[model samples]
Target chain A: MITFDDVVKVYPGGSTAVDHLSLELPTGKTTVFVGPSGCGKTTSLRMINRMINPTSGRILIDGQDVAGQDDALLRRKIGYVIQHAGLFPHRTVLDNVATVPMLLGKSRKEARTAALGLLERVGLSAEFASRYPAQLSGGQQQRVGVARALAADPPVMLMDEPFSAVDPVVREGLHREFLRLQKDLGKTIAMVTHDIDEAIKLGDVVVILRQGGKLAQIGTPQELLDHPADEFVAEFVGRDRGLRSLSFDTAAGLPVRPLTADLLLDEAGRPVSWGDGEPTGGTFTVEDSLRLVTDLAITSPVGIAVRVDANGKADGLVPHHDLVDHLAERRAAK
Target chain B: MNLSYLFDAAHWSLTADGSIPQLILSHVWYVVLALIIGTIIALPVGLYIGHTGRGSFLAINAGNAGRSLPTLGLLMLMVTLLGLGLTPVLIALTVLVIPPILTSAYAGMRTLDHRVVDAARGMGMRPWQVLFKVELPMALPVMMSGFRSAALQVVATATVAAAVGLNGLGRLLIDGLAVNDYSRVLAGAIVVAVLAVVLDLILALAQRWIVSPGLR
Candidate 1:
C-alpha cells in the first residue's frame, strides 16, 4: 500500500502542481489516477519514486517514508513503465529486460535466463530476445518495457500512460494482456491516464483529480459512474455512464425463457439460424456481461437473444422486454 | 618533375636515414604520438562536458578556434619560444586534434534521446554506470568520427614537422624543395594523402566493430 500524507508539489517558479493531496492506494490492486491536462496525475506518480519530490508532506510505501530511502535503491524496488517504453536503443531486448536484475547484482547469465522467461510471459518469442528495441514495432516495444519493469519482480509498479502511444487496436490487445498479467501477479499498481474509459476498464479504484491537482472524487468505477460528485465529474464520466455500468454485471441471474421452435439448431445443438433459415444475430453465454446480452437482444431481428451453454448449445432465450424488466428489478433491489 | 628519385633503390632502402621507409616510420610516429596526447587531454573533458552539460560555451567555441588557428604559425611560434625540436611540432599537431574530439563528444551526448537517460536512471543505474554502460557506448559513433577527423588532420599536418629539422615523410618535401627535386616532393605528398585515407578506413572499421549494429 502507498499513502500520500498531505503531499504538495510547488515548482521552483511557484506554480502548484499538486495541492496538499492525501490519498491511499490499496495493496494488491490497481488504482488509476485520471483527469485532464495540468491535473498533476503524472507529477503525483513521479513523486512516488522521488523522481519529482513533493514540496511538502511525505509519501510512504507500505508505511516507510520514501524520502528517507536512497533514490536508486527505491526506484529499483518500484517498477516503472512510461508511454514510449523508453528502451535502451543499443541493447538487445534480452539485455534490456535483464538490466534491473543485473543492477541488483545478479550475474549476466542468471539475469539473461530470467529475462527469457519474462519475455515469454509477456507474449514475446525467444527470437525477439536478441533483437533490439528498434527492430520491434511500437506495441512489441511496449511489451518489452513491461517485461523489463517486471524483471526485478518489484512489489510496486508505476505506469504513466503506458498504453497511450499505440494505435487503438494494439492498445486493446495490450490492455487485455495487462489485465491478465496483473491478475496473476497482483502487484500494487498505480497508473495515470487521461481516458476515463480506460480508467473505468482497468482501475479497481478510480481517483479523479481537478485541474489544480485537487482530488475531485475517489471510489470504485461503478460508484463514480453511478454517483458522480458534481457536474465536472458527471461530464467527465460522460452521459452514457449508466449504459456503461452494465459491463460490470453478468447476465447469469437474469431470467431466460425456453427456446422457441423458430430458432433453428444444428445437430450438435448449436444455434445456427432463426426462422426461415436466416442466420442468428449472435449468441451469449451465462458468463457474458449484461451489456453483451443487452446488445445482442436489441440487435436481434426477432427481438430475442440466444443464450448458449458452455458447449455452445442453444439453451434459452432473453427477449428485449424481459431485459428491461430485469434492469428495473435490479434498480429496485439497489 | 623527375620521377627517377622515387624509383631509385637507394631512396627506398630501410637502413638509410633519409630513405622512404625511414621517413614513413617517422611520419607515422609523429601522427600516433600527437593523437595519443590529444585524446588523453580532450576525451575526458569532452565526456564530462557532454554528461553534465557544463562548459558548453567552451565546447561550442573550441572547435572553431582550434580550426582557425594556422598550424604552421603555431608551430613557428612554439619553435621560437621553446627552441627547434619535436616538441613544437607535437604541440601544434596535438592542438589540431583537440577540437573535433571535444565537440563531437559534447554533440553526441546532447543529441541523445533524453527519455533513454531517464529510463536508465529510473532503472537504478548509478551516475557512473549510466555514463559507462549506457551513454559512453551509445556515444561511440560520434566520438569515433571526431577521432578519425583528428587523425586525418594530424596525418596531413605532421608534414610541418620537417620545417623544424624533424625527420619524417615531410623531409622528402622540404629536402626535395631545397634541392629543387620535384619527384621527392610529389612522393611525399602522395604518401601523406594515402596515409590519411588508410587511417580513416581503419578507424571506420573500428567504429563498425565497436558500435552496436542496432544503431545502423
Candidate 2:
C-alpha cells in the first residue's frame, strides 16, 4: 500500500502543481489518477518513484518513507511504464526487456532467458525477440514496454498514459489485454490518464483531481457514474454515464426468454441472421456487462439480445422489456 | 606533371633523404601523432560538456574559434618561441584537430531524445552507466564524423610543417618550390590528397563496425 499525507508539490516558480493532497492507494489493486490538463495527475504519479518530490509531505510505499531511500535503488524496485514506451531505440526488443533485471545484478544469460518468457507473456512471439523497438509498430512497442516493466516483477507498477499514443482501435485492444494481464498478476498499479472513460474502464478506484491538484472525487467506476460529486464531475464524466453505470453489473442470472421463429441460427448454433435482413444485433456472452447486453437488445429489430456460449453457440435471448424490468428490480434491491 | 618524379628510382630509394617513401612515412607520423593527442584532450571534454549541459557556450564557440585560427601562424609563433623542431609542428597540428571532435560530441549528446534519457534514469541506471552505455553508443555516429573531420584537417595541414624545416611530405612541396622542381611539388600534393581520402575511409569503416546496427 502507498499513502500520501498532505502532499504538496510547488515548482521553483511558485506554481502549486499539487496542493495539499492526502490519499491512500490499496495494495494489489489498480488505482488511477485522472484529470484535465494541469490537474497534476502525471506529477503525482512521478512523485511515487521520486522523479518528482513533494515539497512538504511524506510518501510511504508499503511501510517505509520513500524520501530517504536511494533514488536508483527505489526506482529499480518499482515498475514504470510511460507514454510512447520510451524504449531504447538502439537495443533489441529482448535486451530492452532485460534491462532492469541486468541492472539489479542478474547474470546475462538468466536475464535474457527471463526476458524471452516475458515477451511471450505479453503476446509477442519469439521472432520479435531479436527485433529492435524501431522495427515494431506503436502498439507492438507498447506491449514490449509493458513486458519490460513487468520483467522485474515489482509489486508496485506506475504507468503514465501508457496507451495515449496509439490509435483508438489499438488502444482498445491494449485496454482489454491490460485487464486480462492484471487479473492474472494482481500487482498493485497506479496509472495516470486524462481520459475519463479509460479511468472508468481500468481503475479499481478512480481518483479525479481538479486543476491545481485538489481531489474532486474518489470512488469505484459505478459510484462515480451514479453519484458524481458536483456539476464539474458530472460534466467531466460525460453524458453516456447512465449507460456506463451498467458496466459493473454482469448479464448472468438476468431473465433469458425462449427463442422464437423470428431468430435464425446456423448449423453450429451460432447467430447467422435475424428476421428477413442482416442481423442488426451483436452477440453477448453470459460474462459480459449489462451495458453490452442492453446495447445488443436495443439495436436488434426484434428487441432481443442473443446469448452465446463459450463456443459461440446461441443459447437464449433477453428481450428489451425484460432487461428494463431487471434493471428496475436491481435498483429497488439496492 | 609529377608522374616522372613519382616513378623516379631516386625518390623511391631507401637511403635518399628526399625519397617519396621517407616523405610518406614522415607525413603519416605527424598526422597520427596530432590525432592521438587531440583525441585524448578533446573527447573527454566534449562528452562531459555534452552530458552535463553546463558549458554549452564553450562548446558552441570553440569550434568556430579553432577553425578561424591560422595554423601556419600558430606554427610560426611556436617555432619562434621554442625553436624549429618536431615539437613546434606537432603542437600546431594538434590544435587544428580539436574543434570538430569537441563540437560533434556536444551536438550528439544534446540532440538525443531527453525522454529516452529520462527513461534510462527511471530504469535505475547510474549516471555513468547512462553516459557510457547509452549516450556514448548513441552519439558515436556524430562523434565519429567530428573525429574524421579533425583527421582530415590534420592530414592536409601537416604539409605546412615542412616550411619550418620539419621532414614530411611538406618537405617536397617546400623544397621543390624553392628549387623549381615542380614535379616533386605535384607529387607531394597528390600523395597528401590520397592520404586524406584513405584515412577518412578507414574511419568510416571503423564507425560502421562500432555503431549499433539498431541505430542504422
Give per-residue lDDT, candidate 2, residue A44: 94
Q: What TM-score, over all chains together, does every model reach?
A: 0.96, 0.94
For candidate 1, write residues B94-193 as lDDT tens digits: 9999999899988888888888888888888888888988898888888888999999999989999999999888898999999998999988888788
Candidate number with greatest TM-score: 1
Error of 1 at A173 (Å): 1.3
Isolated chain A: TM-score per model?
A: 0.98, 0.92
lDDT tens readout by residue for model 1, A1-334: 9999999999998888899999999999999999999999999999998889999999999999999999999999999899899999899999999999999999999999999999999999999999988899999999999999999999999998999999999999999999999999999999999999999999999999999899999999999987899999999999999889889889989999998999988899999899787667999998889999989988898889999999999999999999999999987877
Give a tens-digit lDDT track for model 2, residues A231-334.
88999999989898999989996889777777778899888888686674688888999999999888887788889999998888898999999999988876
Candidate 1 deviant stretches above 4 angstroms: none
Best candidate, lDDT: 1
Show the colliding residue pairs in model 1.
none
TM-score of model 2 vs. true structure: 0.94
Those runs of model 2 whose alpha carbons end farther than 4 Å from true positions after fitting are A261-280, A308-316, A331-334
Model 2 CA lDDT for position A326 = 97
